[model samples]
Target: MNDNIKSFLSVLALVAVGASATLWWHDMMELRWESRRTMSEAARKDRMLAATRLLQQNGRVVNSVGSLGELIVPKVGGGTMILSGASGTALPGQAEEMLDWVRRGNTLIAEPRSLTSAEKAALAALDPSSEENDDEIEDEEEEVEEPKPAAAPASAQGKDEDKPKDDEDEEEDEEEDHTPPEPPARSYFTAVASDNKDPLTDRFGARVRRDAKACECRTEPAEEDKDKPEAIAAARRERDKTVSRLILPGKSYPLELDGGKMELVGLPNAVAPLWSDDDGGAVRVYREGKGQVVLVTNDYFSNYMLDERDHAQLLLALTELTPGRHVTIVRNLNVLPWYKALWRNYSLFLISLAGGVALMFWAAVRRFGPIIPAPKAERRSLLEHIDASGAWLWKADGGRQVLLEAAREDTLALIRRRAPALFRLPETQLWATLARDCSLPKADVSEALQQDAASHVTRFTRQIRTLQELRNHYER
Candidate 1:
């Protein structure tokens, strides 16, 4: 089966491989922390360790979960991110605008999946047990119940007396406004195509890397976690279309022409925009003058080594070469040129690439060679016949006649226009000379000068027919 139809089978195999890789990589990318709480100290340490490992590798990796203080510390400690999560240092401040950091240049390289077993186990250990919450239960036991029959009925009037008149008056109005309402957020967003058609994408290309980052939003809970349900809700398997665009500063990325707009802020040099199909995750970046984001419908970047998933390696490789270059990857990585791959045993791809080059050469043959189509005995249409006849006549400066009668009429017209003294000679002899000299019938010549068709009966069907008739009638 492997050898029988290698080329045909290659097409099927390659297509299946591409689809499988796309889908598999997406699922691998779907591996994201589901927790909304801040990362537990351990998870943070794990992230730091991972970052430290990358730093130790003396190269780099794009940490999508790059929002932790632990992770950012490496960059701060000589590892530099395009943006920070810490306040005042260009990170989204830990205060109310935490998500705003994501608006800046940040891609959160987070832990895979929600709370790790270690984190959950640690949380379980640290959680207040029933015994630990005993004080709270006892405190609840002393609840201020409805005027109960525990002789507390005797205290009803006293309780009413305890209610202060000023306090009651303070609760009078629900309509009283204490603070101003916050401004409504802009609802529209633009989608910049990853096709690199926009001018602002000039900085992005394959091979560019940035020690840039994302909002340090933690997945583990603090004492309380509010983003949990929302996190689970995010996993509701629905397609999210609210993706922000990548653009330069001050350039308005308009989602709708009515001017509902967004600004392209800071983006990591490593985190260039790539078109991933159906990835539902988001990577938000915000800078002082620009804010750009690329959300995923599915995870296209895999967590494994490049050897494991070529597509992910391509993502990394693409970002590396992506700087200031216009790259169009026309083929998939069904195989690579690495030294250890068994698939490289077959040189069919090389053969195919060579085939493509041969095709190009074949295509070029037309541009350099003669342009006229090879002649064949195909029937010509009437319109084509007229054009061909005109072209033939143009190439040769001969008779204007299409038939013998036209030649006769043309001679008569010329004679009429000249009206030389020759036309004043004997009419029959003049006609005979015209017939002999110009290959027009004597009868046809007279017919042409006459106002009516019935004057002379000979008709010219072809040039030769007129010439023959004229020759037979003339003495010469």
Candidate 2:
């Protein structure tokens, strides 16, 4: 190849290397972003999806990655609806609309992070104190039991024999009047709490905290609940089973579906204590109007959980209990599916990026104008270089090192050019001779060069200037 061709090839090689480096760096960053997208997508699909098949069984399923209000409107026909991951943070008038849906006999199951202000306000109409007042009234009625008037004086016992039937009737009426009245029905929301003193919670009921225990498929009802209605008893049984299945499977077995652990949302006491571990109440239900609201503290119905012990049976029973055939699963309206993995839908971005890279590559291979000779490094005077170095060292807070080095260099140079015989002398003797020639005290010269330079800007400047003066005097 000709000399001109050789030169062009060298330039071309350099350009290729630079472009390759740029491409490599970009690829590395893209790989990291791609990895993160994969992880999050896997989490959403595997952890959050509750079924092997998507809402495909048993009912007219309306599945949406949107809020309850957006997916189902007001007076939407009654059905079994589940809103999982519900933070209770609604958009606009959604909360009111939901409450209306419940009033119309639709069961709304909500999993909230805690007692939301919106829920508290809506359910506040049901007072918990009314029950206590009713109990007090019942106690007073028991105290007023009519006692048969002290038996009439013994002497008159035989005189009233004919009127005995009338007295018996009167006693019967008094006994009936003493009977305690039936207690009034009360409804309120409660949760599991160690200290149930918050007025709001107290106004409702102290939250129950159940302890953790090994998973059990079935637990006998509390003694008090054994006499409850059959339907209520069955509901409680299923609820407990479901709560046990939701408990995080510990080290012995991992739920294959790794939906992240469910956070502790407030346990709403809409239902009775149907399910409880030693730690606290796990599930509850509350009746509002003709419908009921079920609250679960964690994500017990996740796909992995659904496969755990007794979970499938509990879910089936729950579905059968619903009044309608339509089952709605509501995910948070705020979590946008597309936003979670932007890189997965990057066709347009990649196209634009590729075009930009191609354009730059083409430009690199083609010269824009006549190639000017490459500039050579301009040589500078030694003193100019030294001055530049000193300025840099000063800016970097290395003034002490620069000043000491400069003083030593001056002493050596002076010894070489003006006092050749002193070049063979020891360091101390050399410094002493330089000090004598410069009329600086030997101690001062030694201190400036051997000791540390001052850190203060003014002091450092003065010391360096003094040293420089001594060097100049010797150079002259």
Q: Pick the TM-score winner.
A: 2
lDDT (tens digit, per residue) of candidate 1 on 1-476: 66768888888999999999999998887777675635456544432333334333645543434333223232221112222211122122321132343334332221111122232334336553522333333343354332364555667868767989886567554434563654432211111122112212222321111111111111233434435786555433221222323322233441111001111222223343433222112232212223332322122332222122223332333233222211111111112345423334446777788899999999997899568888789887999997787668544544233333454565555565654565777888886777666666677656544423222223423433544454444323
lDDT by residue (1-476, candidate 2, tens digit) is 89999999999999999999999989875555233323345547555455424345644454434554345455365666666655344444555566667667767666543333344343333644433433454354354553456879866776666567988789779988997764533212222122122321122242322121212223456788776798576855555443432233122331221112222323246334333332334444556567655555555566545665554444444444456756666655334355433543576897799899999989887877788899999999999998898777777766657666776677657657876887688879977887887888887777666677777777666566667767678677
lDDT of 1 at 403: 38
For model 1, what is the error of residue 102's alpha carbon versus the real structure, in angstroms, after optimal superposition? 21
List candidate 1 segments past 4 Å from native.
Answer: 1-48, 51-235, 238-319, 322-476
> Residue 262, candidate 2: how far off, in angstroms?
8.5
RMSD of each: 34.1, 36.6
Most lDDT-accurate candidate:
2
Residue 285 lDDT in candidate 2: 53
List candidate 2 stretches off by more than 4 Å.
Answer: 1-43, 46-48, 52-55, 59-62, 75-77, 115-280, 333-476
